[model samples]
Target: MNKQIALHPDLDDDLLDVMEPDNGGSVSDELSRNLRALWSTFYRNRLLIAAIVGVFMLIGLGVTMLMTPKYRATTSIQIDQQSTNVLGNTDQNSVDPAAAWQDADRFLQTQVDVLQSRAMAITVMQDLNLNANDDFIHQMGGKPADRPAGPLSLADTKREQILNVLSDGLRVDLPRNSRVADISFTSPDPRLAARVANAFAADFMIFNMKRKFGSSTYARNFLESQLSDTRSKLEQSERALLDYARSAQLLDVSGGIASSTDGSTTGTPRSLTTSNLVQINDAYAQAQAARVQAQQHWEQAAATPPMQLQEVLTNPAVMQLAQLKAQAQAAYQQDLQRHKPDYPQMQQAAAHIAELDRQLNSLATSIRGSIKEQYATALKQEQALSGQVNGLKSSTQNEQSRSVEYNILKRAVDTNRTMYDSLLQRYAEVSAQAGVAANNISQVDVADTPDKPVSPKPLINLALAMILGMMAAAGFVLLRDKFDDSVRTPEDVNSKLGLTFLNSTPMLDQEMTPDEALSDPRSALSEAYSALRTSIELSHKGGAPRTLAVTSTRQSEGKSTSAFAIARNFAKIGRSVVLIDGDLRKPSLHRLANVPNGRGFSNLLARMGSIDEAIQPTETPNLSLISAGPLPPNPAELLSGARLPELINELAERFDVVVIDAPPVLGLADTVLIGSTTEATLFVVEANGSHHGHAKTAVRRLTGNGITIIGALLTKYDARKIGYGYGYGYNYTYSYSYGQPDAPSSSRKWPWSKK
Candidate 1:
């Protein structure tokens, strides 16, 4: 009987809602809600959360105790502008407010750096002999032997620590738009802190004055040297100019003008002398003629001889003839000396000589033809020389006229130098006065003996420690919440698997027997079960659902307990209920019901036994129990067989309600097999025991297989532990109000007592 029982139509919407409805609240309201939620979560996991907080607090307190107590002292200094002299009058050279403000900012920042600087720290340390005395270090748990051999280097890490201390203890702030700066310091010892602060101010003032005076002195010296150099150069330039003017006779150039005026009429008119001009012209003409001759000579020397004619004349044939002629001439001379006129050899030489003479004559004619070309070139050179000499004669007359203009310009340059020397003398006197004015910066205030020492730690640090502690605790809580995977709110159940949250049964610290839960309905625990019943009824949407299957994802998650509690709750309300132990493999309802465990559901199924024979009544009226008779070889096959649905239908007809306690959904198919017979299924999750994913997985498995998940029931609740109103006291009140013999009268008419 694989009945497809829809849990409800519209399964996607939130059906079992437990979250408070929004009231259109402000941001404060949301914050309040969030705070409440956090409180609830912490309350639920109070022990674990307390353990975490206790551990951290212990660490913090231990550290605080172990740490050496550091003393801090502070001193304040009021900076007065009147203490120092203003360089110039505000009226004469007023400081720009913007620029002065910028200077003030820079000055304050520089002062801060100076106070924290190694140079300043070293000075204080050395003055106090802090390096030799290790009291401060030892108080901080550092040993004298542990100290570094050299001075501590202000590296990034050390500087950060120093800066942190400075930032914590020392303060130098200027009042808004005011010239005064207030300086303060805090140290472990009050007097020392005050003294150190005052010392810092004193040292800074001294440093400032020294720096200014030193700079001024350097500047004054440099300027004096420049002024002296300028004066000397000016004097030298003026003297040189004056001497040049005097030597050049430029002192009375006006007298020269008068002479020129007198000479203009009295002196004979100085025209160019005619003889001198003619002589100059003649020289120029002679020089031009020489230049032309030289040019022509050079051109003639550079000309090449005719190549073809020269080669022909120097030919081998012509040379041979010449040689013959020479031989004939020699033979004639020899013949004259010895056998001149009558030798046959001489007659033959004479005949050859005649032939050689004829050839030499022809060669001489060719040479004559080449010499004729040179004669024409020589004639042109001679004619060009005559014209150049004439042009030189005209150029000499022009040079004689420009000599008078050159004399007048030379005299004017000398006069300007004499005037320059007079101005140089006056400039030197003014420069010396300016150089004297440059030396300024004298000390206005000196340091007084400091009254105290400063530093170790301060009160501000204690306050900061507390603040940091709180923040660390809060951060841990937030991070833990973010990573936790357990089911926290009912909204988680609804949202994860689209299952209705039948009830959010508040947590319980200790276990309660079934008899105790039923006898006192007004108890907190009983009220929670009552709420579970009401929620289940509402979830039905119409007729009350019979044949409810109780299951969970894993074993020992209180599924059986929740089934028993819910059945007892129903039976207490006078409804006829049949509690069946549907989990054939491991049944525990027989123990809870105090009924015999033999011949239960599995036995009934195997033998075709009547439901009446198998069912047994519990001590509570209207409550009947059927335990798992025996362990089945195969629970799934037995539950899924035809006999199971027949048994479920038969029980439903006889009893107003049938509560089937099914096995875990994930590990076995028995729950899913039995689910087809049940009208609705209820998932039971143990508070803080079952993971959110496990519960969701169970719901998903049931719903995914088309089983009707009615809703969920949270079991083993610790209402007192979770800050809910429940416990043994509430149970005692319920028992007494419900007419038990030993009941207290006060519990009977309590305001929270149910009808």
Candidate 2:
């Protein structure tokens, strides 16, 4: 007798497809769904997010207003890699560019470190007398020092305190490939900040100059010490040379000895004996030559060849004597040719010739005698010079033996003198450079007082506050959404439980009972159930199932109400529908239908009543009810018998649609047993009421027991409590005016109504 409701031609096929159970989808689809859900969640909690953001903004504004302002001052100074060479040394300029840049980088970094060093800080503080300035110390957040205690005196403690303050307020920065450094100081007072910054820069330059000057002074002092030692060594060496020469009797004929370029002595001074030997030897040579000439002249005369001697031939007196002799001979030869010796005329010429012959003999004899004498004198002088040379040669040879030690001492003296000269020259150079103040570090710009403070910016604080507030609000909403697992919409039905979504019933007003809402044809609850009925009717291939059971996981979740509404809707549609209260533990169908519960399905299952006696007519034209007769001690045993299925079969034969109002399925076997006897079961879930796990467990239990589950119906759904963006329409009420057409209004609206 079960009749299948035919599909309406006006029903939307696409809507039915959307309401069907969803299989798995692509990653993009899931992601888009999640995004939609997140947006819906955020939209619903827009008020909470705004309130949180406003509070954070207020806090940021308050903090920005109350914070103390600080002033910052900076001083720029240039720090060269090497000091300026006033002497213009080319060695520094000859450095490779890469190496020089590297060295300059290292030097610049070192200067930055020095600028921020504690020692430099102390120096700056001393220059400013900040240690003693209590007012400045207090402004810089340092307390005035107490009396001396423990190991530190008052002055020492105060200096340490001020040093700490100076260090904390100081900052130094050096840029890449740059020699310039920026020194900064921060304080509450602009003047103080500027003063500290300038003081740091100025003192750094002074410190560098002092370091260079100190190095110069050290060099000069070292050179002076070396010079003094060298002077003593030179004097000692000279004295030793003189003493050695005197002790060995090695007199220097040449006053001073010669020195080689390497600072070593070539030899000792020349000895007197050696000098004398050289001079006498030269004289001996000259004398020997003269003696030989004289000897040749004398020998020539003695051997009757005196005229052949060069000297004799060149002698003027000898030449005159020879010419007179030659004339006398000629005259005598002429007289002899005429007459014998003693003729009167020839006697006069002969007498002249005789006179000339006698004169020539006498002159020639005198000249020969003189030449002999000269030769003898020259020989004696040569003998004398030779003897003197031989004596000096022996003395010079002896003096040479003593000159070795003398030469060593001379070399020592030379070395000492050379070193002393070098030291003296270097000392002079250093002294000259000592007064030349060539500092590579110089102040580029002095720090000036800042006109504005550098802190407590309102706009920046508000912006930060806004960002933080948004993050906090987003985190809170996401966490709220994550922890909430209640089934709220058709999407929740598919995503949470993977079940087909039939329809959602709007929560009815407390003033209107389930029976009253079902009595109205235009009620939202009635429309929801009607949609659900259509979904179930089409869920079957042969239209609606012959018998259907309505159940939930928990009590008071509108399971009985949904069951009553479904049956009433079917009856209103002219189908013979029988609603049975299948909850042996707690039956609510009789109450929902305003009927007595004296006898019901439990009595018939217990074999205490007949099916015709158990069935009762309802106020609806085609609806009837089978209420639970009485509370049974063992409802599970009664429902587990074969009588339940037979009773369901009998009800299916009697009515076109059989609806079972089953109990909750979680903690009992009564609904599962009742559902297994029916054609299919409708799972009822309360929105924001039944937990997802409990509903899934209830569904699994019913399905595990071989009970057919058609779909799920969400009851008591409030769109405002849950999010509204599932393609579900906005919250609207069914506005029905008295005596108006039964058509639902399309224009009437209310802020607080639900659809």
Candidate 3:
């Protein structure tokens, strides 16, 4: 038998005050609620979670122990941006720091790629003779080449296999803002790893040098070919120039100047013919001036009388003869005055005057003759100069026409000469440096034998395993919570179904009966209902509802039990409470009350009996029960009438609280009809039993019909299932058995559960 406590007639104001925060629905409160829910989920499944993490950790340890350790050896090499110039030619203006840095970065990246190339790997293999070295092959996890029927085919297959292994083991890395590249190789043996790394570095340098040599050799050959062609062209052009100059008779004088007839030099000319023409032209101009002066003198001498001629007048001999004639005339005039006609002295003087006059005439005529001779000579000289000038003009025109072809051939010769010189210089440079290879790559650090393996670290693997296991556990829990939309707690009642959460009623122990637990006011079930009563009282300003109907989404969800408990708790508060079984299809209040079903709610609504006849007294004081009198053929049609409302009004007048146990909401309209007659309806949800969709749909149906829902009562709540009361502030396991503190509790136990 369960222990019973003294019933209190007053409601618990403190419990009602404790529920005020839930109504506030603040953001912080919601966040805390959610966080607590998550923690509770983890707490409930802590053992399973620990087992999963431990299993993963064990797996990690096993794998770490079973795996083969790999040793890595790294060799560092420096890559220069600009290689050394062996030709001693450097362009200062071509250097740009930014451009050079960019080029260096690209070059380093290319070198890294080259280090990882298959060809480089082949060269390293050949240098190390790795395919032929059995120990190295075995260390790299390869088999020795087998001598098959075809040796060539077998050798090729072996080479391919080795290359694959080498490629897999090789790694080259060059970081940004750095010129050094690290070439690393991983192997089971540290010595083999180091040897292969060093071999790669050495062979890479040799390969770079070989490439440089090949480039220089190719350059030399190309220059040589070009030089030969240019030399031939230069020779051909020179020959053509010489042949044209000779055939056209075009001569080039030493200074392009010639001497004139007057002992003066002329201006420089284009060729020998031009020089001759220039000298003759100057002579012709001088001759023209001389001819003009001589002709003027001759015209004066011919137009004037012989004695009036300036040359004749200015001549010394003519002047002397004139003086003598004047003297003789004076003497003859003196003598004529002395002697009469034929005096001997006068005759001698006259004869002297005549002879003197005749001499003057001879001198004048001689002067005239000399003027004509000078004019004739000047005219002849001018004509001769004009003829020479005309002949030279024709020669110059002919020479100019020949000079065009000469100039063409001269340009070809000059061009070919320039190209030949350039090709010769280039060929010489390439030949000189063909054997000198300037390698930009140099070894920075040779790889050494590794002291320890780089893989299969126990601590890191275990840590990673633990982290992955935790993530997987979280994902699983979230997935379960997402798909499991069951009403398991008061929180679910409020959150999932969007109903007011009144209180949570703990499930009764399997050994105890619902009647026995309800009879004891000290039991968890009793305290829960009392809380439910207080929550309901706080819900409305007027106090607890006068007429309340209890219903659930489905049957066996403890609706009838909750109705009985609510009524009994209300009666303890000194209120006259009536419990009515409103399920016309199936009545359970009669069974719970242990009363005979003679007449009840259905009979009262059917007008077959009075309210006094249908109403029956329960064992608990201040409490009444009304059983479903008889199963109606059509419960929905029977409850939809006006008689059900009249019966509820009669019960309300007699009892302070009317608790009706109605049928389920789904697949039936009887609950909605019965609930409409009451002031409010209590939605009873089975924890971990009722589906959220069904409960929501049932509540929607009730509300759609204008039936007021007071709140939800979470029945059959298992505290362990949802982490101990879900922070509802009510301990579901606590019992008020004042004398028995150490009584054995009834709860499930697992292997890892605490005491």
Kindly list the per-residue Cα lDDT of model 2 for residues 679-748, writing each as its tens digit: 8889988887866478778877887888888888878876655566323433224222323466545654
Tens digits of per-residue lDDT, candidate 3, 543-607, equal 88889999999999999999998898899879999888888888888888899998877787788
Between candidates 1 and 2, the TM-score winner:
2
Find the 10 residues in a row with the least total lDDT in model 2. Answer: 1-10
Residue clash pairs of candidate 3: none
Ranking by TM-score: 2, 3, 1
Candidate 3 lands at a TM-score of 0.52
Instruction: Give the true-structure RMSD of model 3.
Output: 41.7
Worst 10 residues of 3 by lDDT: 1-10
Best by lDDT: 3
Per-model TM-score versus the true fold: 0.49, 0.54, 0.52
Best by TM-score: 2
